[model samples]
Target: MFTLDDLVRLVRDELALPLPVNGAVPDFDHALNWRSVDLVRLVLAVEKHTGHRVPIAELYRRRNLRGVHDLYTATATAAGSADPGSGTRRTAAGSPAAAAGPLPGEGYEDLSLHGWFARSAARHPDALALRVAGQDLSYRALEQAVEHLAGRIAERPGGRPGRLGLLCSRTVSTYAGYLAGLRLGAAVVPLNPEFPPERNTATARAAAVDLLLCTAEDAELAERIGRETGIPHLVLPDTPGPGESADGESADAGRAPGSAPGPDDLAYIIFTSGSTGAPKGVPIKNRHVSAWLSHTVPYFEAGPGSRFSQTCDLSWDLSIWVLFVAWASGAALVVPEKAELLTPVAHINEDAITHWFSVPSSLSMARLLGELTPGALPTLRWSLFGGEPLTVDNARAWQEAAPGGVLSNVYGPTEVTCTCTTYPLPADPADWPDARLGSLPIGPVYPALEWVVIDERGRRSQEGELLVRGPQRFDGYLDPAHNTGRFARWSEDDWAPFEPGEELTDAHWYRTGDRVHTEPDGTLVYLGRVDNQVKIHGFRAEPGDIEAALRRHESVEEAVVVPCVTADGTTELAGFHLGPETDREQLLAFLEKQLPPYLVPRHLVRLPAFPMNFNGKVDRRKLSEEAFDLIARYG
Candidate 1:
């Protein structure tokens, strides 16, 4: 019933654009012909007509208006809902409803993270919930901390449901502070204290944050940032003792400042490496988080007595899984020191940890250190690897060491909640999923996700751009400009006439930027990303962001950052510069003042001039290839 003219009028009305008296209208490739606002107007117009709103994030997904039309048509014909096409993903065979064992079937009055924690803590008040560096905090104790911190936060001049920066260490206060922000329904933006003050302050400014919650270690840093940015802060003790009272001076010293954001409200903002010379913050809503939790909680099969490893930085997205998944499963979360991660077998065996999740790089490090010899970790039962590609070799080696454990390759970007795909390795080595691409297959998408691959020519292909859509998908970027070109439509153009990847009837999907292939059984194979974004020791690093920081130095004239793989199979950012005279250590220290430790290039190569391509652009490929050799010579 929707006609082309009807779409045109809607677009004109929504965008407040003048309609041509000559009756000119946008064609199918309107995005190609229109400016940014025009495309936005068109999207709004389409949504108005369809009686639904598609996220601007669809621009980063499959960006076909035709596909949007079909999706709305199909969805509209069915039972209509407020968020049209929001619940379009297909549920997997053994979904939550069918889950058995210690994992209960889906039935929860409060699905919010705050709600879940409150209920869980009340039910088993004395259960060991969290431990950091051998210090234990039972559920009841953590709840009291949450209560004390939330009340303190609420009393601040600027109060709830906005961005609250958390500067904390791996301590009880860190866990308690994170929970307290959630209790007030605020979006918690974690600022790693080790990150250069410049980086933290810049990110805080970009998010327009007003207040911060910091632990004792980061108090001075928080104070400096507050003075520098006019954002007040509260200082929580390094540890919230189990029986601390309201009169406890340490608990009340949080003299500075702090939501109840809703179920669908933003829970947190995580910034990833960006190509545009700054980090891009992905605001994940509570529902986006719940969608992931509801699906994965049962899959892990963890119970109250189970122990979960907290080896990663809380800033890492996997830390999201470690925080909620462990507590939600009624398991004790064991936070690790940096050294604990290097020798994980000891951490696992010593603590009797039952559930472990980390990047394969850390596992490789464990093997390199001779800490992961065969049968080294018999207590581990489930090992989940993510953030970077998990090599088949690493998986097999880890499997051999923890013979009683199962290895699963979890794949996703921070943009799509935490993870969207999980591939559990077969018990038999030969029966394991394909790793011909130098990594274990990403396996099947999460039951709640639907994905497709778009080739370079804009057609469907067995290998190309991996895009996904589901309830777990994020709404859009904090900066809408990042949303553009992240999506394409499902259609055949003159360049390619065949269907690409898996065919979706009609829906907008999120382009993962990572290249992949889909197998006959719907399993996905990880190829590589189509951009410069790379994983550095489990953290997503963008060369542009690092390069931008390098340029910020007074002596630096120009800078280029390239991701280089070390001999050990881990990736590191390598910066090449053509700037004023500066030694590597000096430059590194300079960088240490403006970037996160991970973002700081492992190697800095100064060049008299950059190698140029025919197009007059820097030949980044050349720099990447010579990074190691250059580092050796320079060092």
Candidate 2:
């Protein structure tokens, strides 16, 4: 086992610097280098020295090289031996760096996602970042706009990274409003501008938002939500011209740029669908996003010449990832017209989009409709698939469409910044096992991120439950009781014991609740969710397989398979579908041809639209419960 001094020596060698004889490390208080890419290299070096994973959370917790070395040594020491008295945390020898107190990158301390745009403005003040509705904002112009609005917000009583709800559709004003909020050191709580007042009010109240910003189009909803939640609201014009600003104040007043948010500062609280329960907010920080951009932008080689498209909703966590990658990497973000965007393949070809980040379903639809013609998207360089499983068929189709382009499968919960794992499309996805699907190549935990797959028996393997540990990981749920039970830990200390939320086991892992299997080559294969998988007639069933098979039908648009219990308490397979021209018999035949009898749905319930929660995912529990009701009435 390497000693702390040995680890420090390795780090010095890796960074090509002289080692401190007394081992006095640099102070982390103010040592942020604007170059995020360099930090990733340091993380990799630390991992090499320790022969263990260094999670993103750990990286954010350890702000400087010195703290990284300390954590490495501590983790190494613990791995080298075992502490019988370590209790539930099981300190092998030394504890990993105690979660740095109130770091800027991860947990609840992160600034809203707009923090990246603000930081980018500082780097490239004059570059063009956004263009919409025949209007454009140069980076400098955008920066000035944000500053003027932030000045107005800062002037307001008790303004400092507090909750500021944003209600606007996908437009430049939406982006400007978000930036202005972040500029004033305030957290942005984005609401679906199209959502009804009732839904808007519930979200605002849940987040305890202090203020509301909206466009005239969403003025009514914003006003209603603000009134119900008792949060002050403001409306910005659709276009802020030469003398107008987001705030009612004049647009010409010069104001200093917003405060620089720390890496751990709370960036945004994005509400994501919870598989275990209700909709929960995932707080992301600046450094957490920085870490992701640091890794992904370089991995994809994105730059100013790159023309990227955002197909996901801005409210969706995936959309934020797409937006940040574009701005941070200096790529041009193209928000295609609503009509064109409805057709993913057409949008790519029409816009000459170089990079497209979309879910697997969209790609699958593009293939079935024959919209992925050769040379249609010749400029496409990288196509990323997220938000759902990428089956082998879909992966192969995507690869075929963009022959030379990189196809990446990204996976992560909204809680861990955006994505934690990414696997570029393989030359031969068909070679992968059918049970493994094309999905699991979830890849590695990003730089500074630590992940593991463990079974219920605590056995670790490529195939098991996925656990994540990184700076991008969420601090805790919004509710204190929820935080206490799920996010806190009880441990034995030398003195008195304390239930600190910062500590972790020798593993330093966060249970992702996702079941995955890794190939011998270390590529992750996504298995079905623990909750989604169920036994049917003593046969194991995976909904993803059935869904993938259902999607194979030419007439089927979108499909969700769920289990339902009859009034007699007998379990049955049910399918909630959103599609046109789908014949019940033909759908059943397709499933029967592709899936086993037990896995095939016995009941097919067609709907004009799937019941989607706030996060856009099919509300499976609600759908399944309603499935029984529909069967009882119609069947």
Candidate 3:
């Protein structure tokens, strides 16, 4: 059996802590400041030495060095002279073998987005459906709220709206209003309350929104947007009170309930940042989202008793995944307060969140605040990171924090559905692949989807821009003018630029514009954006490659490399890292050893944190501008 002295030695050697020769170890909670990374290292060391995996959850309960020793001894004693597994044995919960085939209502003639939720409500009416900002609603209660809201929307000046705009945040009204729109056979368009009124107005006008729905807090803003766009506005109550029946509780309740949307009918429209400085609206049909749910609902193994985290805002496409994935699986969707999002570990543990999905940047923020302590998220069973490149270090930190959770890095563009590809990390860290650019490989494309990588020369290759087309891909941009140059055609064994005035069929591929490298086994490693490539001393360079090199340094926690245009019109690479103050000379020397002269950044800046945009992604445009200003001022 592993002794307490052995545990002390392992912790000291793994974490490089100063321990006294008298064999007295300090309490980790009070006497020692141990980071999550340190805890992971110590756990790994103990596992390696003892040959028996220590239960991280139990060790977390006793947050001291002695607790670690006791946990190790107990685990060793339980084995009783027989060698157990070296690592935690993971289940095949999310693998294809675990899938139970089609979900309920899959074969229904008219399958609207809300129809899935209604089916779950019918099957599990007593199940907890939504939890937002300390309020919980059962599936039946939420449906009643949707019905009441639908009746109210039906009595509006223009009657039932064909297209509805949701101007709200993470409030109950926002979620109920979304379902109400679907109940009225209206395509939902989520408008961010945090966004500027002008931007919201533009989006509303572009989508030709017939009505605007919001909570009381956003009533003023919704009214202003309605006035400017000539659309009617309705303020929904914060909670969808119970006892409202979909049959005919209100005078116009039964009259307002519209027919279910067909497979080809529009489900929702999401706007994404466009290169032309205008928001490009991507309209997903009911069938597209249905296809997305069909693949994801079973893959995640979500069902009753599963609690999903709602981290993405309504305006982002990822929120669709957060909402419907839970509803379709009869699981509860948990929305955290703004403050709770920063300290995700506490929220997960306190709420007993079993499924977590958010951008990788969220993990970085928690790591910065030292909230990712080992075994901190014991309730989490599936930890999903998306919307940004997930570094291996962040993956490891989160995995250690939720030792029993399955970690997956998902990837997709708004043009496609929420996600078309996923890479689930191995249960044992030793079997993880060495990613090409220090980010997790976006695993193989979904079996039902089609993908191709076209090189810069417009030929299929093992490395280049990624293009996707399948049931999940949208038909085209809302505006036909924005569709130009956004898609490609495969003809005669080569990809051709989609020309104007050509009929866009299912054969067309949506150009992802993301650069990726295909490994021998067919997995894809994401390289940065294709347009983000810059010329350094007349040699082409990818900022992601340089950023990966900078991240290799032990002192750097996060790294971002941007091309800064100097006053002389020359483009120079500027590197920024988030970590403790390190000698600039040492960073340069470290880069010199691995990178070529031109590949090395000209300037290295240390930042407390990266600026984040509304979607919780790093604001690279802001960083590039800041880098340019620094070069112009310093040079």
Q: Candidate 1, 404: how far from true, in Å? A: 1.0
lDDT tens per residue, model 1, 1-635: 77655655665554544443334545543333333334444554665566554433344233444544554565556636545544432222221111113456656443677766766686668878888856888888877778777776776675553778988877778888898887877788888786789988988887777678887778899988888899888877766643453235445432323324467788888887443235788889888887888888778876577778876666667788888887776777888775445456766776778789876656755654445677877777789988655665677789998787788888888888888898888888988865544467877898778777777677778877887787888877787666666544554453322133423222556778887778888888775557877888788776765765676666665577888887888788888875457877888999899888989988888764555432123567878888887777654
TM-score (C-alpha) between model 1 and the true structure: 0.66
Per-residue lDDT over 493-595 for candidate 2, one digit per residue giving the tens place of the 0 to 100 score: 2111113454533334456667887777666767657668877888878786777677667666667888888778778888766556667887788778877
Summing lDDT over every window of 10 consecutive residues in candidate 3, give the lowest-scoring window: 92-101
* Alpha-carbon lDDT, every model: 0.69, 0.63, 0.79
Instruction: Sort the candidates on TM-score, descending order.
Output: 3, 2, 1
Best by the TM-score measure = 3
What digit string (tens of lDDT, one per residue) describes model 3 on residues 69-91?
A: 76777777776666653333332
- Number of backbone-clashing residue pairs for each candidate, in the order shown: 15, 35, 0
Best by lDDT: 3
Better of 1 and 2 by TM-score: 2
Q: Relative to the unseen true structure, what is the C-alpha lDDT of residue 165 in candidate 1, on a scale of 0 to 100?
A: 91
